[model samples]
Target: MERKSQIPRKTHILVISQYFYPETFRINDMASEWVKRGYKVTVLTGIPNYPMGKFFEGYGYRSRRKERWNGMEIIRIPLIPRGNSSVGMVANYLSFAVSGFIWKAMTDIRADLVFTFEVSPMTQALIGCWYKKKYHVPHYLYVTDLWPENVESVTGIHSKAVIYPIQKMVDYVYKNCDRIFTCSQSFIEPISQRGISKARIEFWPQYAEDFYRPVKKEDSLEKPKDEVLNLVFAGSVGYAQGLGILVEAAKILKSENRRVCFHIIGDGRYLPKLQESIKANNLEDSFNLIPRKPAEEIPKYLAWADALLITLSKSDVFSITIPAKTQSCMACGKPILVSADGEVQEIIREADAGLCSDAEDVCGFVDNIKSFMELSTDRRNELASNALHYSETHFNKERLLGRLDEIFKIGA
Candidate 1:
């Protein structure tokens, strides 16, 4: 008798994101892993320009629009980058939404499911829901930030007319998606209140890529000598980071002769203003503003630092938003200096990873830095150890990747 043959399941995934590989987004790693799991993954993204306004070298309309990356297909669409001005930022978002709409309407490729790696400008997910409606496929949305709330918090836009339309767009997207995955548990309430059923939304914490783990300090990166403590802040230099408070704290530390040097690694629109502030305050000696480092190279910077600093503007929305760098800091086995509120503070306190201060509180930030400096080497190591342990237990890469299978299976 001949035995019946079994066929492997087809898991064709279409990922909609404005950012992808070569950009330091967790979605890039997630897509690569899905490909390794035998799923055929295709990313629909804009050109590589991110954090920096200009297109990345060798990438433009003249360059290849479609390419293979780590066993997945990458299809680039046309969109204006977030250039220096507020008007330019709005144009960037609109450009992507329009171009993405055209591309989705014209593309013939079908998927068993659609996934959106929603960072900000929730407009990116608009295309995913569009695909779902057109193809009748399950749409899974991983919301890293909440819209309207995020908009108002980040941009200080409070006009009812401006917010009402955006709020409607957000609701429409959430209502259409089959599942909503939030990076923080706190996100569940806002999304639910937007009329999305609680059953449809689930808490899925962000995980650091494997490359983010602790590494031996590289000699190339400068580390302060003698008794000075190196406190590093790595990521965007945007207004929302509330780095002005850091500048204020630097002024105080300088006056008091506190041996703490702030190593700021990243760049953004706010950089020019920050540089001006540094010049005005004569903080050239206290602050080192380094350009953004590649994701793989960041662990070395973390290793060289005595502690890592994460800050945000004082806003209700920011309180619930956990900076993605938080996990990376913990994964690097470094003590954290968090000057934010809500979930971020809770994470630091629970993991015993580091200390926290109120956002934009210059005096509190100064005090915390001094406190970290005063902690014994053994105590600091203990905090670092706890941080690593927390990352292992709560954010193990493989464990988190394993969870994705269920999400993919939802509509398969």
Candidate 2:
């Protein structure tokens, strides 16, 4: 007699993130991927107000509170919209923690483990700590942004009064979580210094989505008519991106009569300032600021470019971060032009994927661009190939996800 195969029990995971689907965060994909892997995933997040600092259309305080997308359940709680102001952002962060506390107390949702995707406003991790304590389950935190440091970097708050409290909160969350994952290995030491053992922390780098590969430019997409080399910078145009230096570089390139153009795609809080700089410098002809496009459309834009650009502000915290865009640009099979420092520069150098410059180094950035402009077609293609190969070997999505699956299973 043939024996019937037993069905494995689905390990339910409660994911805590302030941002989710429709917000274009990697967490959306991770949650969906977990669902695909036969795990029950439920997201506890806030109303979608991100780079734009407002709620997405059709989503609000009372609208679509609970929903399902890509086989994962979503539970949106009440939180102030992150309006375009520092005070509003603080309120938005605090409100989520308060709302999540209330929801956790009232809701009977069951989960075997808690996973928190921490970008900024590390306060979001507090909910995961609470869930783990209440349910006696493991809590894993993926630290994309280092707290207190990120807060000081973004807010320019150097006072110990402000940072001390935030540091205390960071310590509390770090102490409570069972396993901590950092996006960059550089982050490990800082977290370890917080009294958490290095053995409990792992570096799990971000991976590009499957759709980020090289694609043929569609006929409908208009190609540049000029012979100028185009460098495309895609993703958030925020202050942390250190895009202002590009304006300075464009000025030098324009004065030198270089045949090059910068195409920046995406919108963020820093866009207005960047635009003002471009206009003030009269470099409009040298720069193109395109509106934000869907994630799926980025590859096409990248294909139209001669090289891709990625930058970050000059800060100890920023230096350690390998921006998610770095992986996406590499996966697009294009030569990258990096104007940042630390881990990202190392990645580009190790892969031979592109030129690198220290953060805020205007002359170095321009020199790199000029170097790219002088490269032969074959040389450029070689760099692009290296980038694609590096992405496949080191940042493959399936491989990272499988590793994550093992970690989750063991924790469960």
Candidate 3:
């Protein structure tokens, strides 16, 4: 008698992130990585509009378009473009909400799992709940931001009238998802208070193993050999990043070191202000502001620096936050100067991966810079070695995604 063998099923995983590559945001790297692991990845994302707030060039507000990149199916829907304005942000979120739902309805593929990325408002999670109800699929809600709390903190909008419903919406998101992920530790208590089981929540920390990697200098960052010292700050220059302090520190270090220069990369709202401060302080040559380079280009900028600097504002949203750049810099084999406090403090201190100062301690930061340059190659190499080893062991994207696979059975 011949026995029949059962064939394994291919996992068709649907990831709902409003911002994806080509569109340009956080999840693109995640999405691209998922595609490598053999999961049938379908992204339910909006039209290309992000940091620019206008539709990304070459992508219009089309009804639907399926793009195939490296065996992954990217389904893009029309979303209202948004920028740094209140009205624009609403239109952007609503556009994706309405269009994503419409596209989801039209598609026949019932996903094995849905992964949602959190952003400005909590409403995005509601859309995931809708798909779960509509298709009987489980979802993992990923929180990059804590919604109304962060929005209110950043925008200066505080009123119970506005806060209640938004808080309720956040609660709804926590209640509905099968699994929850947050970028900040501050969210743990607040989310647990909502009665969601702690076992269901996980933290991704701030990481990107792909874009951030250790590379030899000269061949990578294309930086001219420095005579005195060079410091680099990569990633978005938003208000939350508190980049101006780095500028101030550079200003103070100006007279001390002739060759000391701060290379600030990436762009954001605070960029112009940071630039103005540099000019106002007559730091045109000492403080250079460059555009945001592609993820691959980050290592170049990082390798160019003698040390990496990562910081965030003292906002409640930031206390729990670990800037993704920290992980990126660690992977780049450069010792870091971390400025945020709390969980971020513990990570760097425990790993001996980088140096840390108070969020606004310009002098302490300066002292670290002085110390970093004076350290022998052996000491610097030790920090670089620890950072690389730690990133490889804990922050491996494939390993993280593999964990997600077990939790959600993504590619099983």
Q: Against the true structure, candidate 1 has what lDDT?
A: 0.88
Better of 1 and 3 by lDDT: 1
Writing each residue's lDDT as its tens digit, candidate 2 over 270-382 gives 99999999999999899888898888777877878889999999998899899999889999999999999899999999999999999999999999998888899999999
What C-alpha lDDT do the candidate models reach, one value each? 0.88, 0.90, 0.75
Model 2 residue pairs with clashes: none
* Per-model TM-score on C-alpha atoms: 0.96, 0.97, 0.91
Residue-wise C-alpha lDDT for candidate 3, range 202-252, written one tens digit per residue? 876656656577777756655644585777888778888888787777777
Best by lDDT: 2
TM-score-wise, the better of 1 and 3 is: 1
User: Which window of ten consecutive residues has the lowest lDDT sum in model 2?
Assistant: 216-225
**Each prediction's number of clashing residue pairs:** 0, 0, 2
Error of 2 at 354 (Å): 0.3
Model 2 residue 331 CA deviation (Å) reads: 0.5
